[model samples]
Target: MLRVHSENELQLNADVLVIGGGPAAAWAAWAAASQGVKVIVVDKGFLGTSGAAAASGNGIMAPTPENWDKVLSERYCLGKNLANLRWLERVIEKTWLSLPLVEDWGYRFPKENGESVRQSYYGLEYMRVLRKTLLRLGVQILDQSPALELLLADDGSVAGARGVQRQKHCTYTVRASAVVMANGGCAFLSKALGCNTNTGDGLLMAVEAGGELSSMEASNHYAISTAFNATVTRGVPFGWASYTDEAGNDLGGYINGRRDPSFLPNALLKGSVYARLDRATPEVKAVIERSHFIAFLPYKKAGIDPYTERVPVTLVLEGTVRGTGGIRIVNDSCATKVPGLYAAGDAASREFLSGLASGGGGPNAAWAISTGQWAGVGAAAFAKSLGASAHERVVYPVGQAGLRSQSNTVETFDSEEIVRGVQAQMFPLEKNYWRCEQGLLDSLASLETLWQQVQANPKQDTVSDVEFSRRAAALTAVARWAYFSALHRTETRSEHIRVDYPETDPNQRYYQATGGLDKLWVRRDWIKDAMSGDKPQNVKVVTGAIDISGKDVGAQGIAPLPRLSGHAQLISGDV
Candidate 1:
């Protein structure tokens, strides 16, 4: 049965409408509301649940008495000196300031030596911190409600978003002067997004409303537990383990294996077991072969259970880092090239990589929180300047003809089955430490065909159901873009590997190996138009590297070399 709400049924006008309820969303809402802006946040799950940060855990990296400067230097260098120095400095500053806010709100971090500890990295604490802050700030939370569409004004700026309360089956339009999309990436919705769960909905919506997207093609592939299912269930520290040949011969020692200096030239290693592995002479290899690999041991020494018993273990091929491509935001205040749109957390890119801390600590959650706050505050300020008149109504077809089709129902999606299939294919091909053109092309073709099947029979009914369909549509678009971008980049760099192009090409070294990079090239047209005072220009060139540093680092062998040939290929191209 379908239900319709007349225009008169709409309720609530807010200064900001935040979509998604993860840590990013929480901080965004809190930041905006704290600015005295009435904000409404809609989410698809309960607070403190879902989203990558929560699902995996949350941690903050701050300068403590122990190793403040060392951590900061490591983060800056990990970005390959290509990051925005000003933004990085701001984030580092904000991280320290925000820690007390989270603690005051309700969250607590692990302390050492009983001195109100300065630095302790853990993800769970980060989530708790954001949750407490949002609640304390008096932000109205509409959990289980997912945003369906970005309401655009006559001038094409985003005014608000329409949403559906799933449990109640009621439609509500949240009118706001500004919209902040803090929804996590579309990695989980691979079937719908056609790539990883990061469907690029926020980016796409912003783009459709004249916003721009950058670095869609880059994805971070961490070294996770490979024992049980090769799924990234647990984070593996590079210094924790070393890889051995099938014959049990130690290829490298743990200490020397931290990260091949040649591969990740900017990476830092301390107390690294992999480093020992790399420095291993024949005698060291022989000794290591007889000794138990310490990495396989549980984190029991650190008060955590051993991962090998709980999950699986695999040798760390390369040092883990954030995804290669990220959304580009040139402005100092986290504003995208678009006026009314802002991005933060994993979705925004300005040269900072997400996961890099001392001793294999997960992504610095405090940085994410602070960035969200910055974005939220900026968005609210922008909205305030626009005034109430800027708020616009979004008129959609509400007649019977607007009813959704039944084929798109969630009941039709075998998520587990689909996930298993995707994992099987991606784990070997795209997920391999090294990837090839043939495998990537095959994976893209197979996934595309599967996505087409899902699209051909999209489920529909009310706005809630339709939203799922829309997410699926967005997922397909993202996946197509990822695949298309991968197909075009013929060099091996970062996590993106092409077996056919096994060697990293000096000519293509500066280019991002993802489709989102292409979007950045196109975005220049907007910049040119803005500068020339002309109509928005559309410049499309198939191949050109982003000018991070005028000099090509690849020519100098500064970029990491691609390590292929160890992993197996996709199975029969079935997945």
Candidate 2:
């Protein structure tokens, strides 16, 4: 647990403390303040840009009734109904409402005849709407303030957070009755959170303070083009592909090497590729034949030649999806199992599937707005119930010593070098379209060794060097978790290809796992159980249950089985 300091240690008391300055944080702070609750928003970067949403070009995709129903059904079916249905419904319902709220705050959307036009499968226009809304709200925005730790009360409940304001060389703590962890997922915090940027800090804070996390193991993998190093470019929608030959011939056939175009229209539907392809048509077959179409099934999964042939083609980029399974929430009110804590946007989920629709004015941004607004209002109300005395207490600015501690302890490294290493490891041997148990094991071992070496010799100096160390730590954590998780799942599903376990077992049951649960013991059987699948006794229900006699589980019919255990705690070894 992070050490706590007195009120003199960090300054500023707020009714609601909102971490992150993304669309979610913006709405959260605005919503809380609108209720006349004192609020503060702390961000790791500049308010308008940075964070995951800033990197995202396309906004959330809104789901039509038919498409929405299909996506929801797919989530339930794939997740085996482990998902929280009410939360899903609430996200879908409030999406449209959130869009207009942002616009009313002064942001504009891409429109036709003054009405927003849907673009791509997920909406990409609501970004503008959010930007304008933030400016009008008068939120107390603190850019480039990355949170260091959760400040806990005497009883260990979450009170606020401690962080370093990089430019000031000082630590700042914003005390609050309730804190909303809208800081995007741990992708950036990979070193700290491990695998993906979800270091599970927010979840960890909630859990440490007696909150529970559900559906931690359900991550989504996106279909990125190998030839382009996954550089996403916008064009026509994903389902409607534009086929071209080396000579740039506009073949009279459709793009995307699938046998059915019907599923292409349903690309807007939120389901796995396997489910979408199951609804393919004969015309798609003709189109593939006519175009001499090469099947580019993103990275890894295409057979020998399909995997080897590095073809150049333009991607009709659709907006981004979580790719990781959606987070789990308990109710329509956006509350988690914990009382004073709330989560919104991608941070809270079991399904990991964001409820954004496919076209413009999509559901992604709308949900961020809606859920964030809800969390903010809820947090404010809860804070208010604590009475005016709570607000009377003064919050002190973080101490110089704490600031130095964070700056001196946090680590950062060469991100470019790490990215290159990750690409090389993922593409060639470990992530080959055809993965094998042996190859995966070998790759994981190598990654583990590398991580050990880095940890043993982690650079520690002054505050200025904190970022590098932090980054290095995050990268190692992410690599280790992803590699271990990939290695642990013995079956072939969705993006997890196992050459040895080539066929998807019809009766295999899937389970979801969360990390950092107190019930999980590092010294006892946790790690060993996870590696061997012994801990997931509850997952027997789905194993070997499906019938795949004549079905194509490889090319289609594959979905990611949940990892039934949480993350392994990091151990330090001397270099």
lDDT of 1 by residue, 1-575 (tens): 13445454446788888877766678888889889988888877666655555544333566653554566666655643333334445666777777777667665655658745535423445666666667777788887776656666666566777666777767777777777777655453322111233445554455445554444444424443443333343342433444443344444432453555223211212111112124345665453333323332334344543323222243222111135343445454566655676777655643444211111233335546766887789889988998876655452321110123324443444324444454454434234435566666566656655454443434454555555555654444445444444555576654456668866443332233222211212211111111112222242332323332221122211222232343122111111
- Per-residue lDDT tens digits for candidate 2, residues 1-575, read 12322234447788888876667777788788889877788877766665445544444545655577776566434433223344456666666555565556554556778777433211223444454555566557677776655665554445777676667755677778888877554433222101233333344444444543333222323232323334433221224344334454433333475434222223323221211122235676454323222233332353423222323432122111232322234444466545556777655542323211121123445557677888888888878887766644443322111122333334533434544454454434224334565554555555554444343323334333443444444434444444444454466654345667766543333322333321221111011111123223434232111111211122211123332322223221100
The TM-scores of all predictions, comma-separated, are 0.69, 0.62
TM-score of 2: 0.62
Query: For all candidates, what are the clash counts?
Result: 50, 76
Please list the residue runs of candidate 1 whose C-alpha ends up more than 4 Å from where it truly belongs after superposition.
1-10, 64-69, 121-126, 189-200, 229-232, 237-326, 354-364, 392-425, 430-433, 442-457, 462-467, 502-575
Best by TM-score: 1
Candidates in order have lDDT scores of 0.50, 0.46
Model 1, 105: alpha-carbon shift in Å?
2.0
lDDT of 2: 0.46
Model 2, C-alpha of 486: deviation from truth (Å): 4.4
